[model samples]
Target: MSAWQDDATRDLMGLGGRLALLVRGEGSAVWDADGNRYLDFLGGIAVNSLGHAHPTFVNAVSQQAAVLSHVSNYFATPQQLELAATLKRLAGTGEAGRVFFANSGTEANETAVKLARLHGNKVGKKGLVSLNHAFHGRSMGALSLTPKPLYQDAFRPLLPDVTYIDNTLEALDELDWSDVAAIFIEPIQGEAGVVEHPAGFLRRARELATENNALLIVDEVQTGMGRTGDWFAFQREGIVPDAMTLAKGIAGGFPLGALVTFGEASELFYPGTHNSTFGGNPLATAVGLAVVAEVENNDLLANVVTRGEQLRAAVTDLPLVTGTSGKGLLIGIHLDGPHAGAVREAAHRRGLIVNAPTDDIIRIAPAYTIGDAEVEEFTRLFAAALADVNGTASEENNA
Candidate 1:
């Protein structure tokens, strides 16, 4: 029997409700006790960039564990410094760069919010603006910025002073400038079905923030780390944010998150103002460095671009799929009907793992290392799933 099965059934309802039984996972596939294999296109919600049990990540973790793992905030490790320096190099240094490590994407967003608050108050600014349908995280601070009622209604009276604006350049027209401390936007809205910003929207956002003397913060938690065929999605837009929050792929599925800032904004948090005990531990940071090194060395970004194009091209003409959105491996399938959940379940039964962003949107976040065979299998299973869900064929067992 799978330990996760009983454990999950008994204690884990805080997350999404139970769907299938998972016995084990390896590489880009998982299995249930019933002996079903699923090609995992979801990639653990975009965290397993290198895929499950990648030798590189495992070896890096094991080697670092043997050397050293946790070193408290009172001390610094070479790995921590290396990871920070790598991020700075990737994001461009000489602009006064710094990093704060955390344990997850939510914490990363929390750290960014804290830094923005401190910086805003120091400059006598108040409040921040975030986009509608944006998802930073589930933590209180990050949640406060997320403008959805379902995710917010349960936790009322969140942190104050957040303005929700649709992603329209003109939306900033009437807002009070000085009171707005910063504007938080995701380069690609991941949870909101991968909705993309309008053309030149990021440029206009940068202009608005500059005109208001407010910072622009990009939440790249789901779009960073070569997920979008670029180091950061905002880079493709030719816009540099004041600060950026990252996680989900930093440590190749390990618990690692970082808040990176440049320019004078980096000086906002002094040593004692903000800290995390296990944030920059040598183990996670070492693995993070390894992950970054592998992505670059293996040319995974190029792979992402190529595979993403292949995937889009393959699925573009499907009958049930209205269109596709997103870049690189982070794809969102817009469906013609509200049967996405059914389609997801159908695909699961057909030996492919995918997810539904909502009732009519399917999200496909395959590993960067996924091969052509995996892509073809996903498309075939997805087509079958859509057919089954749409009642185009009689119900087929295990499909």
Candidate 2:
């Protein structure tokens, strides 16, 4: 019997099914408990920025843990202060900004929501806006901003005065933004089949938010920290958001999230407004500093662009693949039919890890350090999996 079938296993909330019991991982590859090796393209759902056990990340975490791991928010640590400054510098906000640390993207977003609400209180605007397919987080405030019915239906009675609109310039023009407090958007929607915001859409949102006195909150949990070939995907469009939430890859697999605020939004919070006991602790921030250094020193941003283009080119023409979407390592392969699940299963049998976010979409977020040979190998395995699935479908049709 499988480990999952054990009677002692608790029926806690989780993803649909357990795929494999991973025992060890290193540099974009993992080995299962059963001794099968698999190339990891999902990267812990885009959390493993530098891949498993990178020397820099490993050393930093190890050394920091030995010294000091956790310190209450009442006290200050040099690592936390340095990490916040580094984030501000990377954002180009300079001294006009500040950061709030949390343990995950959801908490970071919760902090952003609080900031927006406080800012809105000054102008008497309590409403919030978000995209139709946008995903902020699963917390009550963030969930209210998220537009997915499946996740929001049971969590009814979410935060009130939140509106969801389609990601289009026309929709923006039609939006009644007079009462809106903030507009939350993902530069590239990860959970919604990797849907990207349209060209000039972010700029338009910036203008609308300014006109309506609403805060612009960009959720960069999946696209930030060089995941989209740039330090942040929103940078490509050349628009500055009042506040941005970051997580996933921020600390290169460490559990850390940050809410960075710029301009007037930076001073929205006062003493006792918000705090986290474990946020930005010595261990997490120390590793975060190291991750930023490695990404810059190793010049992984250039590699991301080159490898991203190469991957798209290699997969777009494969059999059954209708098209490929997204930028950098955050890629989505659209199949011509509802065969994404079958294709994923076939890839698994062949020792590859991928994610089917939707019935027709396969999302791939390989490590930023993935090499040319690994990409080529993944493409070969994926093409073979497509052929196997297509062949099986043909047999079923004839039968």
Candidate 3:
């Protein structure tokens, strides 16, 4: 057995086995402990926006660590305030918005739930609505909105009154808006194999939420930070959510999450109602500020569009691939058969890293900094991997 497998403290909580012992990373590639290099198409499951070991990110974190790392919520740091302002500006809520920081996406969603419940308590609306096959987080509150039974059935009795609706307008139209406290939706459902909300679905959701006097919360944990060719996925839809949860690429892989609320929802949480010790530490926020600056200065959002198009164009025509889905760098490949796992394993053997979110779906969330050369290399390796898997399957059938 491998050393990681033999470790006593390692829990096999559904992650079956260790894939590789990655020692270091740079740009869109990582090297395993065995000294093998692989192009990281998974991008840490859409976390490393600017790619690994970005000099700007490294310098920001280092400088902040050398200056001030943590100060708790009692005393606010300049970096924290600056990050809050920057996020508010990016969210397009301007000076009227407020931000609450957290350590991860789940915590951000937890905060959103609290804010929704607080708003609901005031207005006597206690129900919540979420789309089916949506993945917010693993926390009890976020899991309540998440519709997958496999993630929730084990932990029964989640937060009550959460209704899971389909992605269509008809499903949303059927909901009695009077009782709903909030409607939580992911602009692009990442964990559901990159499934996108149908056209005009978000706009209708906004209208419904407004009609019911409920909050509209967009969980942009995966789709935010230029993953969809925009700062936030909702921007393309041209509707602003009342509150949005952000993480993943927000800090360019730093452990940071934020809940940004617009309009009156910004004042929902009282001073003592919610708190996080390590939420907006100077080091993390300093890195966050740097990431934001990097995204703008380097024009990573435009890069996301270019690279996404190049990748989709390269792969969509492959014999094994049925089609490609998603915007920007958060892409998914639909296979003609249930061979995503086989293809992923084959790609790994060929020094390419990808994710099989399902038996038939392969997710590719490469870094925004991925260049045309890297995309071409990935396409070549991926096609070879598909051929290898297909050849193996054909031999098995003949045997």
Q: How much RMSD separates candidate 3 from the native structure?
A: 1.4
Of 1 and 3, the candidate ranking higher by TM-score: 3
Worst 10 residues of 2 by lDDT: 6-15
Give one digit per residue, the lDDT tens place, for model 3 in 319-358: 6899988999999999988899999999999999998988
Error of 1 at 12 (Å): 3.1
Among all windows of 10 consecutive residues in model 1, the one with the lowest summed lDDT is 390-399
C-alpha lDDT score of every prediction, in listed order: 0.88, 0.92, 0.92
lDDT per residue as tens, model 2, 98-201: 99999999999999999989988989999989999888899999999888889899989899999999999999999998899999999999998899878899
Q: RMSDs, each prediction?
A: 2.8, 1.3, 1.4
**After superposition, which runs of candidate 3 have C-alpha atoms over 4 Å from their true positions?**
8-16, 396-399
lDDT of 1 at 277: 93
* Runs of candidate 2 exceeding 4 Å displacement: 11-15
